[model samples]
Target: MPVLILGLVLFLGVHSLRIFADGWRSRQRARLGELRWKGLYALVSLVGFALICWGFGLARQHAVLLYVPPLALRHANALFTLIAFVLVAAAYVPRNHLKAAFGHPMLLGVMVWAFGHLLATGMLHDVLLFGAFLLWAVALFVASRRRDRREGTRYPAGTLRGSALTLVIGVVAWAVFARWLHLWLIGMSPMG
Candidate 1:
């Protein structure tokens, strides 16, 4: 639990810098130069991610139960995750409608993913991990939208073909993850 908390702090704290200290971040980026700054950022992110994975695995072994969620909620999580994958796909796919409307589909997808996992899992470690992500995503989303509005950013209008392709890719990716990757990586099958 301590290790998990530490990992979350390191990971989420670095991620929250833009949301909490935009000026400071900008100043640091300017001082460090873009290449150096990105290299440092990637290194920190990777270390934090490794710690998170290790801590999460340790926490899962203990299996501290909080509340037993109904099976229906678990099933509902599958739907939520499916939507999340689509939103994530929208972030990468060019001219997707979801990105055009949402402006930050990836952040929205993280929020949905965290929320769904929180609903389905009722362990202290699970709550800590997912809840932190949920809060961070919400904050980052709001911050990003506000920044966009301030800058008067405009997204390209999405074509039907692009949107359709994005959806198809998302669905196929979700199917593969839920069926195989989830089980292999997370040791649990979302579909089950």
Candidate 2:
């Protein structure tokens, strides 16, 4: 639990810099140069991610139960996760309507993913992990929208073909993850 908390602090704290200290981040970027800043950021993020995976695995071994979620909620998580995948795809797909409508689709996707997991799992470690992500995503999304509004950011108009492609990619990716990757990597199957 301590290790997990540390990982979350390192990961989410770095992520929150833009939200909390945009001016400072800009100054640092200017001072360090874009390449150096990005390299450092990526390295830190990777280390934090490694810690998160290791801590999560270790914590699971102890399995501290908080509440047992209803089977129905676990099933409902599948739907939420599917939508999350679509939103995530929207963030990457060029000229997707979802991206045009929601400037920060990736953050929204993370929020949905965290919320869905929270509903499905009720262990102490699960709550800590998912709840932190949920909170961070909400804050980041709000801050990002505010920044966009301030900057008068305008998204490109989306094409139907692009939107369709995004949807198809998202669905296929979701299917692959749900069917195989989730089971293989996370040791759990959403379908079951």
Candidate 3:
């Protein structure tokens, strides 16, 4: 649990710099150069991710139960995850309607993903992890939109074709994860 907490702090803290301290982040990037900054960032992110996974596994082994969620919530989680994946896909695919509307589809996706997990899982570690992400995503969303407004950012108008493609990709990816990868990697099946 300590490791997980530490990992979340490290990972999420680094990610929050742009939200809280854009100037400081810019100074560091300027001093270190983009490649070096990226390398350091990647290293820290990897270490934190590894610790999170390790600690989560350890915590799960102990199985500290909280309130047991209703079985129907699991189905709701699957539906939420489907939407989350589509939002995530919108972040990468250019001229997608979701991205155009949201302006920060990735953060919205994170919110959806975290919220879905929170609804389905009822464990101490799960709450701590997913709750933190939910809070962070909300903060990030607010911050990013503010930044966009300040910068006068304008997203391109989206086409139906791009939206359709994003939808297709997200569904295929979600189906693959739900059917096999989710169970294989996360030890749980979204569909089941």
Candidate 4:
């Protein structure tokens, strides 16, 4: 639990810099230069992710059940996760309507993904992990949208080709992950 908490703080705290301390983050980025800054950021994020994985595994040894979620909610989580994947794709897919509308679909995707997991799982470690991500994503999304509004940001208009490609990529990626990767990596299958 302590390890998990530490991991979450380090991971989420670094992520939250843009939301809570944009000026400081900008200053540091500028001071370090782009390549060095990105290298450091990736290193920290990787270490934090490794800690999270290790801590979660350790905590699972004594799983504390909060409440067993209904089977329906578990199924619902799959749908939520599918939508999340699409939203994530929107972030990278060029000229997609979703990206135009949301401006930061990746953050929205994380929020939905975390929320869905929260609804499906009810263990202490799961709650701690998913809840923290949900909160962080929500905060970051709000802050990002606010910044966009302040700067009068305008996303590109969507085209049918790009939109369709985005959907296809998202669905295929979701199917691959949900069908195989989830089971192989997490030792659980959302599909069933």
Candidate 5:
């Protein structure tokens, strides 16, 4: 649990710099130069991610159950996760309506993902992990939207073709992950 907490702090804290200390982040980027800054960022992110995986595995072994959700909610999580995946896809796919409207679909996706997982899983570690992500995503998304508004940022208009492609990619990816990768990597079957 301590290791999991530390990993979340490292990962989420670094990610929050742009929202909380834009000027400081800009200065660091300039001082370090783009390549070096990115390298450093990647290193920290990787280490934090590795810790998260290791700590989550360790924590789950103890199995401190909270309130077990109804089976219906677990089923609903599949739908929530599918939508989350689509929103994430919109972030990468150009000229998508989700991106144009939300201005930060990836953050929205993260929030949705965390929220769904929180509703479905009742373990202490699960709550800690997903709740942290939910809170962080909400904060970051709000901050990002405010920044965009201040800067008068406008996203590109969505094209039908691009939006369709984004939807297709998202669904396929979600299906693959939910059906196979989730079981293989996490040792749990979301569909089952």
Candidate 6:
């Protein structure tokens, strides 16, 4: 739990800099130069991510039970995860209506993913991981939207094909993860 908390603070704190301290970030970028700054940031993020995974794994071993979620909520979580994957795909695929509509598909996807997990799992580690991510996603989404509004950002109008592609890719990815990757990587299958 201590490691998890520290990792979250380090990871989320670094991520929040652009959202909360744009001026400071810019100054640092300018001082460090873009490549060097990005390199350092990526290194730190990777380390933090490793720590988070390790800590979460250790914390999960303790199995501090919270309220047991209903079986129905697990089903709902599966459905929500499918949609979340679609939104995540939209973030990468260009000119998708989902991206245009949400303006921040990645952050929105995180919200959905975290919320879905929160609904499905009831344990201290689960709550800490998902809840923290949910809060960060919400904050990032709001901050990004505000920044976009300030910049007068406009996403391109997307065609139906783009939307279809996003959906197909997301579903395929979800299927792969639900079927195999989740089990292989996380040692538990979300589908199971």
RMSD to native for every prediction? 0.9, 0.8, 0.8, 0.9, 0.7, 0.8
Deviating ranges (above 4 Å) for candidate 4: none
Model 2 off-target regions past 4 Å? none
Error of 6 at 155 (Å): 0.8
Candidate 1 Cα errors over 4 Å, as ranges = none
Question: Model 3: per-residue lDDT, tens digit, 2-88?
Answer: 989999988898899998888998999999999999999899889888888888888888878898999999889999999999999
Q: Return the TM-score for candidate 6, rounded to 2 decimals.
A: 0.98
Candidate 5 least-lDDT 10 residues: 45-54
Residue lDDT tens for model 4, 16-131: 99888889999999999999999998888888888898899888988899989999999999999999999999999999989988999999999999999999999999999999
Give the per-residue lDDT of model 2 (tens digit) for 72-191: 999999999999999999999999999999998999999999999999999999999999999999999999999899999999888898899989998999999999999999998887
The TM-score of candidate 2 is: 0.98
Worst 10 contiguous positions by lDDT, candidate 6: 43-52
Question: What is the C-alpha lDDT profile of model 5 across 1-192, one tens digit per residue?
Answer: 988888998888889999888899899999999999999888888888888888899999997999999999999999999999999999999998898899999999999999999999999999999999999999999999999999999999998987998899999999999999999999999988
Residue-level lDDT tens digits of model 6 in 126-187:
99999999999999999999889999999988779898999999999999999999999888
Q: Which candidate would rank higher by lDDT, 3 or 5? A: 5
Task: Give the local distance difference test score of model 4.
Answer: 0.92
Candidate 5 RMSD to the correct structure = 0.7
Q: lDDT tens string, model 1, 39-63?
A: 9888888888888888999999997
By TM-score, is 3 or 5 better?
5
lDDT of 1 at 91: 95
